[model samples]
Target: MQKLDRAWLDRHPLPSPAIGGDKNARGRVLVVGGAEFVPGALRLTGEAVLRAGAGKLQMATVRAAAMSLAVLMPEAAMIALPADDDGEIASGAIELLGERLANCDTLVLGPGMSASERTEQLVAALLRGASAGQTIVLDAAALTCAGNLGTLVAAHEGRVIMTPHYGEMAYLTGIDAETIANDPVAAAERVAEKFNAIVVLKGARTVLAGAGEEAALFEGGSAGLATSGSGDVLAGVIGGIAARGAVPFTAAGWGVFIHGAAGEHAAKEIAEIGFLARDLLPAIPKLIANFGAG
Candidate 1:
């Protein structure tokens, strides 16, 4: 395992384009997940992606949450997927979603989605339909939606990045939270190898692991990051970077480090006790600037 530090940042700097290129030169990201009850999750993630420097952003969410989310984030193009009685996106919306995803460089799936049969179906379909080059960042409810995660991921030709907290990690791998917490690197590695995807095992110190790559450990976040919606923001940061052309592994490593830095900055400014997830959004650009992307 490698320690994620300034040295690593120097080795793998963030992606940057020449000054003359247009917005599309940076990247395009599509975020697809939001339920009636927690519609704010996708909004938070979308805004974070823009703040992280994605050139274009699109949000596809349930019908009930569409208007408010569009109003909340006018910068993103919003697509309202048909919803079921519970206002969760319907499985039938997959056809339309697949069409929209064709143009996007990165897909951020499952933020604030309900863990229902419908949701699982939608996630499975989306995974099956994703293009070979699309970068998929699966988080929150999507982690629980994959019934045969290994088979599903292996079938897909695209790069898949899975972000799971200890509880979610336990659910995905059938490994107890206690065991994962004790040795997160091994747990993350197991998941990565099984799924043929990059795994971001989120915690106080996040672990980034992939099938054939060295595991990377990031170690500088604060208690403020324990707040709700934080992981969604991290997903956005990673998705945004991936949209900008960083490979899945690079994006995950950089995202973890940037997120931890932003959390620490937010905590320092507002004190660890009261910082919100949104507070970390604005801190992202500054951290990226300091890192000096190339």
Candidate 2:
């Protein structure tokens, strides 16, 4: 492998100049996840997309959660769906979700989703419908929900970007946590090829791979980001980038950089052990400023 240089990174910049365009033209990103038990996903994800520069972000979640998220995140559009007793989505919701999904340019799945049969069915349908023009990013619970991702990969015409922590990586890739922890780049690249999906293996140093390229490792962020809602925020960032017309690999690169930058800021005020996902909010603006987006 050749040594990575500064010029290599200078190549991957942010979105092209924003010409006169409609909000939908900027990008409409749909995030599919959240449950009765998990309201954090909806709020964090929606906010992250906005912070990452997406023009529109729509979150499809259980009705109750959607209501809560709407109140918490006024900027994010919420689509409510009926759910089971445990707040898990039911099959009936799929049809309603499908209608709205047709308008979305990108998808961000499994932030705070609960594993219900209905949720699984919804994911499968999205994968089937995902075409070359549309971009998709998978994270958190969605990684394990399918267990076998072959169908999703085979179904999607465009590329799929899957982000997994070490444990989730092991579960999805059938590798052990210890091995993934040691050689995350190699592990991410290997499994990405097997599934034929772009992989963003998350950790202290995030690794991205796709389009015949082997790997791009980004070391950014602080341990303070080890909070619950942080991953959801990261997913939103990538989804937002996708909505902005950036491809999967470029979005992942920016997402990884910004996610860590937010965490880095959050760590200054709070200890790494106790920092929460919300802590990264203020940091997000500062981070984006670094990108000259603000």
Candidate 3:
């Protein structure tokens, strides 16, 4: 395993924007997340995308919460997806996302979404609809569909990345969380190879494994990152980096390092264990600049 710290990252820098680049020149990211109860998730994610240096942002969420979330996050162009009875994005909403999905450089899915067969169907449909060149960043409930995706993710080559904490990792591999915690690298590798997607196993020592690639481990994020919606921020960070033209593996590595570093920054400014997920956002752009990256 390789350590995914500053030294390793310095040698593999992310692509920088041109001096006179426009918003579209940076990259476009489409974030499909949030339900009626968790509309703030899209705002957190969309903002993180911009902070990570992605150019344009589009937030797609349940229709019921779209108007309010749009007001909360005026930077992103909002798309209201049809909702099911439970306020989850309906599977049929893919019809509405077709053009956006095709235009986006990266698609960040599954944040704040409920885990259910319906979500799985939605995941599968979106995966199928995504263009060959689009990067897919799957988090939260979207990771649950891995076991059944088979060729769906593999078809993306190295473009699909999944971020899963211990419980979500266990669910993806059918291994108990305890067993996965014992050897997170191996757990991450198993899923990475099985799906042919980059696997980011998030924990105290996050393990990033890609199919046929060396595992990269990071162990520097603050405990405060354990708060609610933290993973959503991490997912958005990765998506934004990917949208900016970083390869999937490079994007995942940078995202992990930046997120952990951001948590440390937040811990110093706020309480080490009491900082909310939103507190980490302000530190992201500064962190990337400090690294001489985008």
Each prediction's whole-model lDDT (CA)? 0.87, 0.76, 0.90
lDDT for model 2: 0.76
Task: Point to the candidate with the largest TM-score.
Answer: 3
- Per-residue alpha-carbon lDDT of model 1 for 63-125, expressed as tens digits? 888999999999999999898888888887898787788888899999988788888888888
Question: Which is superior by lDDT, 1 or 2?
Answer: 1
lDDT per residue as tens, model 3, 1-294: 899988878877988778898988889999997898787888888888999999999999999999999998899999999999898998888789889899999999999898878888888888999988889999888878655786888899978999989998888888999999999999999999988999999999999999989999998989999999898899999999999999999999999999999999999998799999899999999898888552
**How much is 123 displaced in model 1, in angstroms?**
1.1
lDDT of 3: 0.90
* Alpha-carbon runs more than 4 Å astray in model 1: none
Worst 10-residue lDDT window for candidate 3 reads 141-150
TM-scores for all predictions: 0.97, 0.91, 0.98
Give each prediction's root-mean-square deviation over alpha carbons. Answer: 1.3, 2.4, 1.2
Error of 1 at 124 (Å): 1.4
Q: Order candidates by TM-score, high to low.
A: 3, 1, 2
lDDT leader: 3
